[model samples]
Target: MIAGVGLCAAAAAATPDSANAVVNIYRAELADGSVRFASQRLDPGYVLYLPGERVAATSDRTRAGTSAAQAVLEPDVLRLAHRHGVDSVLVLAVIEVESRFRAQALSPKGAFGPMQLMPDTARRYGIAERAGPVQNIDAGIRYLKDLLARHEGNEALALASYNAGSGAVLRHGQRIPPYRETLLYVAAVLARAQVIRNLGQP
Candidate 1:
């Protein structure tokens, strides 16, 4: 059976939002019937202790013009993005990639709402209802602003941190981690943001 002895101890000493601070944790069963934990998969012996959230697959729906749902939410996105000092188009891009404007969308990892925020992240940002559009977008833009600040306003690094957590970025020498999902996520959001910029906002 799997054990979380080390994981529990680590969690106990970590900040409440530590799960969102790191990307993944690996666990390896040693030859001595013991376990070792690491931030990355150092070798074949290690498996993901905490798996990262799967990036939502991209599709035409994500690239299409504003939908009825998106239109309904644009006002809040604009207002909150401005309030948080984030680009409205970038916020829209993230929403498009994350949930296609579906406020009720829920990921397999339990990230919910248009922003697809994990529960801990939502609570950390004082979001009582992850499915509420205004609250979700507000919290999301705020979080993005914080990430941008953490990375010194490097949009790519901020987006990468948003996808894979800041610890992953730091462990990789302040660069985007090599995880395929995170790479695609950063590219997708930036690409979508550019497209929105060209299209002159929804």
Candidate 2:
């Protein structure tokens, strides 16, 4: 009985949001056959520590030459964004506005990860490990790419769908939903995306 109580206490202490918790940053062989990282801590896995990728800045230009993924992006995020055919700036923008780069962030609405993907969104992208930063970002980028295509390149509409759902956007005549949270989310992402682009300029 005492041992059982001790195990329960240890499990509670190891939850992701616990400050000072240690996490695995690289892949390692577990006791099982698969390679994995320690998921018990918030800061585990490949950290996307982008200081300048915040949602506060100015200026920008239209898409030209290669996409933003090919133009300027952080090494890891750039690779994932390119794989999904998404603009790097847009991905960073979404992360900034969603979870501010906090890998363990969880919304009250049950969205998880830096991209704040809901459970269904994660499942749709075959991402069972929503707590893993790389997997979460990859799935979110893929979903964002699809949203952009579905909305005919209307970034605002795409963002609205991300925040409020595709059905909500479609029901509103393919326009941004009237919800205050969705409206603010779209504007914030756009502003942050422009900032990311401007900072990359020479």
Candidate 3:
């Protein structure tokens, strides 16, 4: 009976957002696979973070590239990302890192489209075979939701899962892998997202 009580206490301590000190208000996991107590928030409608690639700082130019991903689809992707609290800044950063806004970009690993989603993963998110910027982004967000759930709403663990695959994360049990490429990818996107958070877009 004593052992059961102690185990329950331990589980509660490992949950995300213990005291809500973190400003972001989103859940994240640590590198050791333990659930984080911090919270982060995602604001998808923040137009700056979702701005188009190559868009100028000026008002007129901003709208030039804005339509690249299709205005209609942009809102849906942003809405879903926000609803999932996945951080729109993170999404934009990933898009920049993965395809640089090139919807047709293809990687050797068979990742295709703007978000560079794998074929099997894309199918899971209902993404079509053809490359569509909005669809790709939407599917990427869906995949993120699944990863976040796997990590108990922990964003960092989910992110690592995205880069390394859920199987890898499962094998490690929420801990970040020692793989260099995956490490670099997560760090790069985080840094970029931080910049967006700080700068409020150009």
What lDDT does each candidate get? 0.66, 0.58, 0.53
TM-score, model 3 to reference: 0.61
Total clashing pairs for each candidate: 0, 0, 8
Tens-place lDDT per residue, model 2, 4-78, is 111122222222233122222222232422222221222343232222233333345332223443233345667
Q: After superposition, how far is residue 110 of candidate 3 from its true place, in Å?
A: 0.8
Look at candidate 2 and tell me the lDDT of residue 7.
19
TM-score of 1: 0.67
Candidate 2 residue runs with Cα over 4 Å from true position? 1-74
The C-alpha RMSD of each candidate to the native structure, in angstroms, is 12.3, 14.6, 13.5
Candidate structures ordered by TM-score, highest first: 1, 2, 3
lDDT of 3 by residue, 71-120 (tens): 44456556768876676766776765565566676766678776778898
TM-score of each: 0.67, 0.63, 0.61
Question: Which pairs clash in the backbone of model 2?
Answer: none
| TM-score, model 2 to reference | 0.63
